[model samples]
Every structure is written in structure tokens, then in C-alpha cells.
Target chain A: AQSVTQPDARVTVSEGASLQLRCKYSYSGTPYLFWYVQYPRQGLQLLLKYYSGDPVVQGVNGFEAEFIKSNSSFHLRKASVHWSDSAVYFCAVMSNTGYQNFYFGKGTSLTVIP
Target chain B: EAGVTQSPRYAVLQEGQAVSFWCDPISGHDTLYWYQQPRDQGPQLLVYFRDEAVIDNSQLPSDRFSAVRPKGTNSTLKIQSAKQGDTATYLCASTPGTLYFGAGTRLSVL
Candidate 1:
């Protein structure tokens, strides 16, 4: 079965520090990967997505994610953390074939302390 | 684009009550999806439609849950008898390829 796993349930980092949120997926074929962030009491917002070409895809608010096919991972990264960047981040995967069911990881809660 | 729109920002109901949530996808998008998101958890797919046809609904709890995209533009998800375990945010999304989500309806069954 296709699934997404975000191993770290919570991550804390100081402002101005670099950030990385890990994600792993299980799929037999090429998968469409995505990263989304949800602020408190707000809906989710797309961060980035990867379909083909460059493994690293840029998204809004200086966020980016790299899709590593071999490792079945698509980890999200940010050069410098901002206090406002604290939010719940989710990793999702969807098959490129058939009904194209989408799967989401439990999500990683990131807290950036200033 | 107006993005996806969902009605009733919040709903509070007693167990066994029925509630419905509505969604209007972005204009011209053919695929619509419904997901249930528990507190602190990622959204879980309940059902999805391609145009007016159901593509996948395997995860939907048919015992009391039902969804419909009557005209392939607007959709509704109804829970016949709400349960305390059903307290969660219901999210609706649409896709050209990448999914676009709505603000969602937060349902609390007491």
C-alpha cells in the first residue's frame, strides 16, 4: 500500500537557523510529492510540489523541497527559520496512475523560537 | 481564481445529529475531494469525484456518511448520524493536477 511517513512528530529550532523536516513515502511507481503548511486555526497552504525534472522544487515564502526517488523521500527545507514560520507541516504522495489516490503523513509540528 | 470555497466555518452538534458541509471548487476543475482531518493529524481522504462520477470512496464511512457532486461543480458531504469520534475538520479540495483546498468546516460532535 502507498503511504507517507513523517518520522518526526515535532521539531524545534531557533530563529535564523536552517530547518529540515523529514518525509518518506512508499510507492511502486513515480509519485507526485508535496509539502503543505497549516497555521493555527487556518487552512492548509501549499508549500511546494515535485512531479518531474529538478528534484528540488521551490515554493512560496522561501520554502523548498527535494524529491529523492532512490530514498523515497521528499524533505522540506528552509535556509533560515522565522518565528512566524511555526506551523504544522505535512508531506503527501499521490500515484501517477489509476485513480490517483492521495496519502498524507501524520505531519510535523515545527516551532521556531525567537 | 476564487480558489475552493466551503460553507459553515464551524458547526457544533450533539451525537446522533445530522450535518452537511458544502464546497464549491475552482471554476473548471473537474476533480473534487473530501478529507477528514482530526486534530493534530494530516487530512485523510474520504472520497473523491471526477466530474459527476465517484472515482474513489473506499475510505468513506458509508454507514452514516455520504457525498455528492450533483452538477460536477458544487459538492456536499453529509453525515447522517454524527458521533463523538466524528469531531474533526472536513476539508474539500479540487485539482487540475495539484490539489487546491478550502478553508474547511470544523465539526464538533459532543
Candidate 2:
């Protein structure tokens, strides 16, 4: 089966601090990866996705993720985080070679302190 | 374009009660998915449809849970007998390129 692991349950960082949320995946074949963010009382929003080509993918709100094939990781990163960036972050793997299959990890709660 | 939309944003019910949630996907999207998100956890896929045809429903609780997308534009998920374990936020999403989500129907079973 395919699964995603988010090592951190919660992460706190000072405002304007750089942030990195770790994610690892277990899949046999090539995997399609995605990062999603859920704000308070809002739905999960797509931050970014990686299917092929560039290993580094840019997303909304100054977020980016690098897919390290050797490690089977797609880690989300930001140069600086704002208080408004506090949200639950999820890393997902698309199981199907097709465009449909999606499996999500237990999210990492990110708190940006002012 | 409008994002995926779900109805009855909040639902409160007693155990054994029945409830249904609805979803309307983006205008031209071909895929729709239903997910169950327990508090403080990531959303788990329950079922999905590829234009009114069920592509995957392996995780859905077949005994009491049912989902359908008859016309291929909108979808509904119903629970015949709600239980405490069913108390979770039900999220609906559609895929154009990436998944667009609805705010979700938060269910509380007492």
C-alpha cells in the first residue's frame, strides 16, 4: 500500500523565521506528490504538486517544496513565515499512475508566533 | 470558477439518525471525491467518482455508508445509521488539475 508520513505533529516558529515541514513517502513506483494547507474553518487548499520535471516546485504564499528522489521525500519549505501562515499542512501521495488516486498523511500543525 | 461546494455545513445528530451531504463539483471537472476528516487528522478518502462512475470506493463503510454521483455533476454521501465514530468533517473535492475543496460538513453525533 502507499502511505505518507509527516514526522512532526506540531511545529512552532517565530514570525519571519524560516520553516521546513518534513514529509516522507512509501511507494514502490514513481510517486506524484502534493502539499495542501488547511486554514481555520476553511477547506484544504492546494499549495503545490509535483508530478515530474523540476524537483523544486513553487507554491502560493511564498512556499516551495523539493522532491528528493533518493530519500523519497517532498519537504515543504518557506524562507520566512508570517503569523498568518499558521495552518495544518498535509503531504499527500497519488497512488495511481493515473491522475486520480490520493492518499494523505496525518497533518503537521504549524504555528507561527509573533 | 466556483470551487467545489458542499451543503449543510454543520450537522448534529443522535446515534442511529440518518444524514446526507451534498456536493457540486466545478463546472467541467470529470472527477469528484468524498473524504472523511476526523478532528486533528488528515482527510481520508471514502469514495470517488469519475463522471458518475465509481472509480474507487474501497474504503467506504459499505454497511451504513453510501455515495452516488448519478448525473456526474453533483454527488451525495449518506449514512444510514450514524454513530459516534461517524462524527467527523466530511469534505468534498473536485479535480481540474489540482483538487479544489469545499468547506466541509462538520458532523457531530451525540
Sort candidate 2 into its docking category.
Answer: medium
TM-score of each: 0.98, 0.97
Chain A only: TM-score of every candidate? 0.97, 0.96
Please write out the lDDT profile of model 2 over residues B1-110, one tens digit for every residue.
Answer: 78889999999999999999999999999999999999999999999999999999999999999999999999999999999999999999998567889999999999
The local lDDT score (0 to 100) that residue B30 gets in candidate 2 is 96
Alpha-carbon lDDT, every model: 0.94, 0.94
True contacts kept of each: 0.67, 0.79
lDDT of each residue in A4-111, candidate 2, tens digit only? 999999999999999999999999888889999999888999999998999999999999999999999999999999999999999999865664778899999999
- B40-86 per-residue lDDT for model 1 (tens digits): 99999999999999999999999999999989999999999999999
Fnat of candidate 2, please? 0.79
Q: Can you list the residue pairs that collide in candidate 2? A: none
